[model samples]
Target chain A: MDSLTDKIRTLCTGLLKDGKVDMIVGFKKGTIPMSSCPCVARTPEQAKELIWDSNCTLNLANYLTNRKEKIGVVAKGCDSRNIVNHIIENKVTRENLYIIGVPCDGMVDKRKIRALFNDDITLFSEENNKLFVETASEKKELDKQDFLKNNCTTCIHRNPVIYDELAADPVEEQKIENRFADVIKIENMSSDDKWNYFNDLIKDCIRCYACRNACPLCYCPTCFVDESNPQWVGKGQDINDVRTFHLLRAYHCAGRCTDCGACEEACPMDIHVRAFTRKLVKDSCEIFDWEPGLDPNKRPALDTFNPDDPDGFIK
Target chain B: MKVIKIDKQNWTGGIDKSRENYQIFGPVKDKEHFVFKKLNLKEYPDMENALSVLSPKSILFPQSEKILAASLDESQDDHHIMKRVATDYSPRAVIGIMPCDAKAVQLVKLNFDTDDYRDPYWCDAYEATTFVGLAVNKPSIYDFTLSMGSGPFAEEGLDVLLVDCKDHFLAKVLSEKGDAFLKASGFTSEADADKSAKLINEIKNQAEKAIDAEKVKTEKLKEKSLLELHGASFWEDLSFSCINCGTCTFVCPTCWCFDIQDETKGKKAVRFRNWDSCMSPLFTLHASSHNPRAEKVQRVRQRFMHKLKYFVDKYDQGTMCVGCGRCVVHCPVNIDIREICNTMNSYEAEQA
Candidate 1:
């Protein structure tokens, strides 16, 4: 059987050669270990640069927003869902995209792997379910499942919701118990405790806006924080300003987020940014019974208004 | 120069004792990663910390600072007039700061302490702080400090350099501030000067050897014309992965760009200087709604050009990077500055 990388390259090369897509969006080998940066491949030769691995953590759907060219995008389960959301939002047209869906084995958290050693991780590679980490002094072999990203641990969508082609057989989605345990723990706190908990969570945020930029849904021409005329949020490190930015950003993606984990992966501070969005995800699920991006034909929970919608908090 | 031997057992006590006259800051474990924090009496600096997520630049230049303030009231004297905010310029010591970060401070000084204009806030804060650098015995694979003209044992900007020797630290005083700090800590046990110097050199050689394996050409960057490099075709592909986030700039010790903003709340007004990144869309936006670098590629190009070309040409001091590898390690999309530097250095413009 051809590896996923080989299959994707072969498919993308055929697409580019046939002039099916003007470009192919995918992952390329990164400069350092446990990283695969996004790349744009316009030719057959460039398409060969595309690789599929556990380190392909970023959402490739982000590159598809408002693009003019016909694009063949390599998408994981999360990326495909985001593409559906993009189509629904009219950020991209369904006709312009050829999504090569990947049945993903969860991405490994680089931080977790890094924590296992005192020295730097010089090289990281995976085989089967095992990960090999090498440093100057020693080499360690560990289970990939043990180092999976937090979002990947509870992910129920291992197969893409929508795809033009499948790179491999669909992965078995794990049956997760108490998926919102962390959120429930926070919800059980008193209002003051919750306030303090959130404050402590974002204490290290430098207001770099990596979280906002990494998000596929945050394709606004001008972010609310950037508005100067009656500026919504102050451009300082003030606690209130920082809190406001996070709160408003989470609210913007309330019902539209697909739990892609791109924001947390992009953060340099290693802050648990998902702590803000996860609550909203739970609320959207519990109240509206809405899960975004499962179907391109369906409107977002926030976009459509129903007569029987919950209005208990209106007063 | 003086060399003092500080026993490992006395480290905490000496650090505590120095707090009487100095506000000490050092690297401490902050949740998952390490960060420089203001230390209380009980806390000790983690001298062996592998890396700090953010550099010690925030010590002298905070992420946000109030420079001026005023009253908007009509009846009061000195109303509607902005006055420089009073700042605490007391003595402080930054212990266990990496040599690259210390060099970064000096690189930033070129902008803050120029011949024509002097930024009082930066210069004042810089003067108040004492930099005590910790020599890197084991350089990370990402660290390319030696290629950028600063090394594991570089002492360009530090007042003192501390070498870890298992049982004790060998402190080599490089400036008067270091000597004063040692005296204040009551650490007067002088090591054999010649022996200590030889030991430090041995450690430095080993560390530099590990760093010397990596290559990043910057000497030829001087020969290349700015326009030729700026118009290079590689930037488009090079910048494709960039998300235009401020992670690289924010974590960088040498990046010193700032935006001045005024906020008015009720009858009180304040002017703040906040750290800004060229990667931001608004960084170059004009008041007339015109944007010079509107595209993401342009913003990405500007960051590299400024760091690798513009600053190098203007100062003739080298690239604006100290090669601390913070950007390399922290960039979400893995945009490596080392690769960019090499590309810019060796780039040749096609004939027109």
Candidate 2:
């Protein structure tokens, strides 16, 4: 892991000194204790500040959109796929970006790691292929594989889909399998049971809208729920309104959602909002044989129209 | 212009008599408040009470409707797909619509029609409906000036304008549709100059009072740097208690975000559009699982900024709120937009 970090620092410094890129966006030691946050490196000296390890799991491609500067970004297999998807969506041009691809073994779930230490774990670090966590009075060493995030465990893409440079040894791709077994299990249940499950989940909603704000694809100048001229839903606690909120969110993500799990992670209520999203991903794959963010060449299903596209709900 | 004298007692009978042909939709007492309902003379007993909680716009711009449907069969001749004809609209009359709501319909018509990019779905529904505007005699729940401009009577696009006075009602015919409806209803009396003057004075006085009472004091807030105040502690304090349920935008009269979906059952599928909001994290989630506005503060800022800034930039309108106080009253934690605006305004004033 230290060797990997050293390699990243050396490459970033060389890229800046050579004027290959103006900005290098990567992970920095977070101000908030034990957190890893996005940071920008403008010079070779700033490259020393870049950190990469089990905690560096956030998809940093989100910062590339709406930016005009030539940027070099660190991309994991999943993050690289999203960047490619962005290129296809016309959100970011490929010519301006320099991608540093890293073969990922998946990163640790910080939330789970913290909970394992009973929320008292203040600081932690990776060394010698083991995770050393420090609590108030005690320190513990655990296997890195034990703390891997759920999304990383079954990752099929261990190699970057798009990269101008490689920082780590590449791993062979794993065959894609049913990644949404948990979501489908719940879906196969009775409608009443499904309703009960979602009702319990949605009832805990605090309406912070963190999920929407965090999503990179939710870029719109004006959203319909804010329009007043023909107010579609009332600003009240009507269950129908809440249902409409969730249902509409799932529908919008039907073909476009990349299944990054950012919405679920940012949610304070811990509602399994991803359950419905996974269903949409499953449906899209089954019906269209397409996965979002996987290819730079393909157009989005929603934006592309086929006169022969299925439509049977009208009477 | 005509002054029709139908005693309050006989008004129900008149509505009931009219229901034989036209569908009568009006305000009916619902628990402690009134709501728009399909008026049946036997069930809905009140006419001149309060405005229904919901505007009459939905009769034309429905809350949810199917736009297109199709069936696909892979087994039949190499994936054969069939689609159904679009839904047909029936002409209907919406009575007791407020002047602001009538104006809103006209706004929808202008946007949905003039731009070569027209919303055929909305236009088809709108064309089949007749707008019967009711002038307000007193201030109801919504304060018109804070949101919509002050107006009590429709200037255009109204089939019939019903002006309620203390003694009798003055009905103005604005279009051929209005004249034809009145003629078919078998009632008529030409309005004199004195009656017209009285009705005009009453409308003007009531509208002015409503505007004065509900006017939002935004001068101080407008002076502050909105960008500088983006990450202020005020937002954290206000949003801390919120549940993030999306009730505020759903109940708001002006919120119009929508989502399109495809539903398929037994080889049949249909595409439909439903309402959506910026408050959900999934609202901006990309296919790659990247989100930009990932914080609660950003989401809260968007709601206010879009209302006060973006909408004004898009449409040449100010004050994106009606001061209906519904968001304040309906929000579970009582996070009020008015209170936020006032607090920001005061903070700006202090800085200034």
Candidate 3:
């Protein structure tokens, strides 16, 4: 890991100095102990600040789109797949991007990791493949594998599938269980119960549109709901509007969602938005044997119509 | 043609007298904002003050209309199908249409008339309606000067063009529909040659000046390639402040994306279309659970690119965005489209 970090620093410094990139967006040491935040490095000196560790869990590829200058960004296994998807969608030009692919041995859920320590853990240090957390009291040592995020448990990709530079020895891929137990649990409920459950969950929505904003796939110029000439959705708070919003969102993401959990993370109401998304993902896999952000060459399922595709809902 | 004068105060009386004969619709105050609604001549006496918050397109393409309805039956050893019903379009008058909206109705007409799957519902409604376009002596708060080409009024498709000439409105019949409507009212007369010339000159001058201003600005913005602007630092800066509430698209006059779904009961189903926004993560979500655009910045970029690039490429005309500034006023974070255009202009200048 030390050798990998050094190589990354050298590559980033050269890229910045040679004017190959305007900025290097990567994980940097956070002010809080043991955390890493996304940092933009414009100069070679700033490149030294960049770091990669178990704490660097953010999907940094989200920032690469809509940038003017050539940019170098760090990508983990899942994050690299997202970049591939972006390239396929023409959201980011592959030629202009400098992707540093890093093999991740799963990231730790910070909230869960923090719960193991005192509330006032002001600082943290990583050395010799061990995490030393400093709270108000004495320091505590913990193994890196104990606090892996839930998404990592079933993550099939551990090596960067696409990259200009490799940071670490590529890790072998793991087999993942395709069963969406959570969605199936909800699906097992009676139709009336499911309706009530969805209604109760969606009724709390203030329509802030945070989930939409945080998501990476929604890229339309004139959203249908916003059209005024033939007004689609009314401008007021109605149950129909709320239902339409959620149902439409789910339908839109039917095949494209990457399961980054960013929407759920960004949601203020703590609604289990992922439950519906996971259901869609599971259904897509079951019906089409397709997973998004995995293969960039594959055409989107909805955009490509198939006569053989099941249409039980359609008349 | 002789010009006739009616006291501004008595215009309402004229409308009231005509109310018994025509189904009059115009802008009416709805709580805080104004919307086009059915006007009772006694209630909505003045039509010259404010612009209608809602476009008059609803008269042609209603908010919700049944495109198709079907029923399934198994007892007869065959599936039974039922056809959707059409709407009745009796004679009606849509009063106080701004120029942009008038143009929009015409644009929609082109699509309905030429498309393979023609919208019979709107076509029938448009054939039966008479448009009374009022000149915009005052600019709307939601004006899209650059995209709209003309400021408020474009004198092309209106049946009757009403100019606010202080004491009396100077009315000109542009089409046969206007002629028939005026004759039926018995209150309108042909304008004198001098008055007609003056009104034409005024409208031409206003439209030309607005178009000229837009030409200069749009040309400057067009100098930069939208593809190059994709990765600009300015997008990050412009988008970081955006709350992604989607109010900007909702308030836009030209935005027209929709999603269709079916609601079913007892083997019967009604398919309905609802508005969908690109700002939401699900807009491009394929059934395979892969979204190519997975970030807010990409979504934001797509919005501007469609307005400035894709729309122009698809529609030979500028997608008819008569710069109604509804997006500016309605956006929760005040992410103004004008600012985005200006930013694009400046960014191009900087690059150059």
Name the best candidate (by TM-score).
Answer: 1
Q: What is the DockQ of candidate 3?
A: 0.07
lDDT (Cα, tens digit) per residue for candidate 1, span B187-266: 78999999999998998898888885358878898889988998999999999899999999999999999999899999
In terms of lDDT, model 1 sits at 0.91
Which residue pairs collide, candidate 1?
none
- Which of the numbered candidates is closest to the native, going by highest lDDT? 1
Over 4 Å off, model 2? A1-315, B1-10, B13-21, B30-33, B40-46, B49-51, B74-88, B107-111, B141-147, B151-158, B203-207, B210-214, B218-238, B340-352
- TM-score, prediction 1: 0.98
**Candidates sorted on DockQ, descending:** 1, 3, 2
Say which prediction, candidate 2 or candidate 3, comes out ahead on TM-score.
3
Error of 1 at B332 (Å): 0.4
Give lDDT: candidate 2, residue A92: 94
True contacts kept of 3: 0.14
Candidate 2, residues A195-244, lDDT tens digits: the string is 98878767645344545544555555344444444456543344666777
Fnat, one value per model: 0.85, 0.03, 0.14
